[model samples]
Target: MKFVHRLCVLCLVALLLPGGPARAQSQLVLAISEGTSGGLDHGRVIAKYQDLANVIGGVLRTKVSVVFAREFATLESGMKDGKFDFVMARPSDYPARGMRDNGYHYLASAQPDGQCLIVVPKDAPIQKLEQARGKRFVMPEQVSYMSRFCRAELRDRGIDLAKENVQYVREQAAVTFYLDNKFADIGAIASYSGPARKLDKDGFRVLHRSVAQPYFPLVAHARFKPEQIKAIQMALVSLPDKAGGPEILQRIGIAAFDTSGEDRMNVLLDWLEK
Candidate 1:
């Protein structure tokens, strides 16, 4: 009886140890924050990311669940609290902050870095960025991330938006509307946005484009082991080359995943803050 009791106790200890059956069975949560305003519904968001989550789970040999973080505050707070095991989000700055202020590790960023396009009517005489000074401007809502991104880029070019005549709109389409109707001289829109994509067809031109920054960054929590982190990173970076990879990329709206944005991510907050 004594030997049997000792054996049972040893077995119990073994099961409780790290990487044991109990630990391996645990599920990790992946929080996705596309944006606060004008994001997909919960069901659609899950549908979009479920396959990617399954791929991650397959690589880790553990179950991965998806959760949508609809608000920036919620996403930021969750990262700071280490509530998420993995995070893949856009507007890039939030994920950048997750790495800097919160204890998260960079995994990868979506391909085709994001840029703020300085748009103007095709017939407009503003051929240079310097010529944009004192011109009327329209941009995404004042509090939105793109607005901050545009402001930072413009600031670097010596165009202080605080002094410029500006109209803040709720949507990128409205930025173009303001320009089309002669309500604004120039506007800022994200390079990847739909409105920017149709600029040429709509008789608009990009007067200037901001330096590209990492877009839609994916990060892992600090609790991830170095080997585990490397495995996850490798899995994501190679996703586009794998079977069903192209479809997944199409669903996620990215060309491919790039793991080389860590250095740029580290300095992102500094650029935005300044």
Candidate 2:
């Protein structure tokens, strides 16, 4: 699996090189980052996104190759150096940075915005954000984007995690374990995360639902002209209306692409950085 993954990644990178048949052909590189710690492997990522890449290629009249970035550092460096012609990623902050500091323009975001859910045992006394103060909090690793997101949400509610009793885990599922085993009083996880889906079944309840923000944003590099960006944006927004579009969306795990998140995307880093 490792060899196959590396070979595929190399093939995609080769498309960008000069002096080959691929060089003579017009091509655009689309960098995709699910998140540094996301569960999907390279093969799964390609299967999920190749169709959308084909659609984008058709619209742009160029070959669109997909590159899966499994690490945040690689994604950030690629954006900073203008290595990716387009990017669509989750944990939104990475793409948000691409737009704010890397000259990328927000094109669209996936529907059903992401929220941080503060979870606790169903019988726990924490009924509100204020009550969560001083309680042992379990969340994803401090370096993970979701951790930053949850911290930001808690901070906004006057609950500073830095001052609170907290347990940083490597996975969201571990957050649930800490809560279940009585190792923590409260926990945080993304609403779309795996553990979040089983909250009710596992006898946990959402103590607080943080504010929704744009999720899985798609942005175009500054190299694209305004008209090109507009075209790409429209194509993505109208994807669901086209034939096979629904299947494409199902494969990609989003209902539709929203083009109205430009404002939210613009201020996302500010909110997270605060």
Candidate 3:
């Protein structure tokens, strides 16, 4: 009986030993912020984020981690709110209003240049940007920066925007529908979306591609530790020119986060003010 009690006590001690669930803990709360807007799945996105974090901290020796949170409020909020330390945010939507309130600042930008494309149904006869007038054009929505940038490009080219022929539909896939059902003459999408062949089996072709813009931006909380910020900057600057580069880029869905400093963003803020 005494031997049995001793064995039970040893098992209990093993359950409570170091490296157990109660003892093992994480120090850093590294996180990626993303919006739950529209139909995007949060769980899938978070899983991708965890895989990337393993590559960096596990492979790169940064001891960092990555997490994905789908709250619109968390995504919009700034770093000083202290809820998040890092963010892989799209340039179109960051420093969302009224959360951290100090606004977000850039740490690095995806090195890949962005390209915009104009699309039309495989059967449509429209051949020119000007042909889009009085014909409905499908774009994501007003709140998206890509949509605004596309509209601004047309406006700068002297196209009138307030005409009865001009209109916007809310979803990008809607562009596919408009083309498939013959509901519209044109649509716009990321040039990288590549010929709509993958997005839809029905054919769609590119009509226009925009001059490239700054690739996606990586942002961090204003309060991120200085050492952590510097380490990230160093890692990006020294990203090897071999498999490491392509590997990291593939995980982040960009070619590289460029060495270009934050000053490059001044033009963006200027455009916003203008």
Candidate 4:
């Protein structure tokens, strides 16, 4: 199973890789829109993906803003009515990405990248997702992707989840207690939480990772003029690790981030429509 997953990821990356040829000029106010509790809040989600924008801003000497989706439905209506410029929303919010595809365009990561882990107490017998059925699954208050992420595993195992097989608990400490006290068979987590120290390396093992998409991307909007888009693209293709990106990734937890690929997230679009 692990091998199959790895193979899928590799093939996807290979297919979407960006070709050689650097864009000249780099300076633009690329905005980032993500999913959160309220409507598109570009102000709040900035700190996270801003690591990339900061690097781009420094190297190219540009400005950027981070935005969040407004109640999910507003994704399409919002971007269309106004210019969002750039966004990093979820795979589930692909419709807004598409309102500008084809001649209209957008970029998304090859990975269905979002972090949510089903963790159990360190010394538990749940080594695989199959063992998680009929057991409690604790998640965060705003974790909406659980069903989409965990569905395939359930279907594969033939687990009957229709009759409340999985109980959804929303609380921070509740999740921690469930995992730490052995109350929860599984819990989901954001990958940013401390690596060895936070996740209690000694306590738990990751049974499954919901890495079906690339980490939410720093994508360009359709309205961006060619030169403007090129500048942003150049910055992303070359981050802290790249010569011109200006070093900021290290200050944050990010080791480095770069992409060479097609600006297509259609698979996500197809899924969102379903």
Candidate 5:
């Protein structure tokens, strides 16, 4: 009888111990931010990171699952609630803001820094920035970094924006479309935006280009252990050179990974404030 009682207690203790069958934990969750206003398919975004999740899982020796935020607010709330172990966010989106608000640490940035440009019809003969003062300007909606860059550059250059006719488009590509069709005299777009591609074919000249800024970055929440953060950072910065990494990075629109400082991110935030 005593042996039976002892066996029951032993079994209970084993079940209570760490790594026991009864103590199974949930898999880790990796959240990717969606800050694009429109023209983004949520499923595609989630699928893009699925392989990335697998890579991270291999690095950590644990299972990892990927979740894509429906939009900016969803990502912001999730980060504040500590729902994500890690996040990949755009510069004007959750990464920098979340780092300031939720103690997220910078892990790595997508290489080939981002730049914004003001473009005019190739034959417009608008050689000087002042020549665009009274032109009809088409820009992306307010949420985009391109929009903010355009506004900041105009303000800094002492251009009287109030004197010009400005229109906001839903997508960056639309800006080029409008400019190409003569709906607007000038347009603003990101250097790599769809419209930038039409520069040669559709005929547009860059009137101004903003200085380079850090690309989208991956960041980790403070709840992560130091070792975990270090491992993630190392894995990310080495992705460009890693064997299977180039393909993944290309699919995600990243040229490479950067371990440089986050100062450029701060500079962008400052522009946002201005």
Candidate 6:
């Protein structure tokens, strides 16, 4: 009788995995949005989340896999296809449209809103955005949330790039290097890029700083049961207290999982719809 029950459980898990489950463990896919913030190494980015996934998997008694779609369109399509059981997306790519059009549930967010900095040499006299105008600019690629948010804010402040030499690189480190080497007059870097350390150690100064803004959000698909979702939420919220949790959270730069209400999502969706 016990053997029969074990066989039934294996059968159920087999139904969940692609190509027919060869293993008894249930598989969960945790998808991360592709960005330059983690550098261009896809393997490194995937590995970082694998540790977090292992903890979540241990909590849920399942196998978790981490993946990132290389392009926005691919991520959108994968969401629609229900390829991801959970997702970690940038603010601009909040999976808002997916939440409405598809069936994703807002789970939690990484605490402490992100900030952007317009940095120049510490010795440079550029004290404000206006002073940096018409100067050579260096920034991450347009696909980066850092670039998208910072660039929009820069334009709103009347910083014209058409008149200045602008260079977009694939990594945030490149932006700092360009500024440090005197190749660019100013650099736009996100707080996630470790801007504070760069400002202090690299001899750069903030010419302007952006208002606090929402950072990345984590979400789950409709396939998760309410109780299962709650369990996952609880696990993430308590991650900092678990063994080795502090190290993992620090490496990921998440202070804690803010499992607050959905008010933030509503606001984010409203902004996206507009």
**Candidate 1, 32-130: lDDT as tens digits:** 988744758778888999889988899888789889998888898999998888999988988898998887999999989999999999999999999
RMSD of 4: 16.0
Which of candidates 2 and 3 is the stronger one according to lDDT? 2
**Candidate 1, superposed: residue stretches over 4 Å from native:** 1-25, 37-39
Tens-digit lDDT track of model 5 for 1-274: 9999999999899888877656445467788764664555768776788778877777778778888786778788988988887788764446887788898877777777777788888888789888887789898987566787778778888875656799999888888889879899988888767677668787888888877776677777787787877787788778868898988888887787786757766565776666
Q: Write the per-residue lDDT of candidate 4 for residues 199-227, one digit (tens) a residue.
A: 66446667766544445555555665767
RMSD of 2: 7.6
Candidate 6, residues 218-248, lDDT tens digits: the string is 7889988888888888988888888988888
Worst 10 residues of 6 by lDDT: 265-274
- What TM-score fits each model? 0.89, 0.88, 0.69, 0.61, 0.84, 0.72
Candidate 5 local accuracy as lDDT? 0.77
lDDT of each prediction vs. the true structure?
Answer: 0.91, 0.88, 0.59, 0.52, 0.77, 0.75
Steric clash pairs (candidate 3): 111-256, 134-165
Top candidate, metric TM-score: 1
Clash counts for the predictions, in order: 0, 0, 2, 23, 0, 0
| 10 residues in a row with least lDDT, candidate 2 | 17-26
Best by lDDT: 1
| Candidate 2 C-alpha error for residue 48, in Å | 1.8
RMSD of each: 4.4, 7.6, 6.7, 16.0, 4.2, 5.9
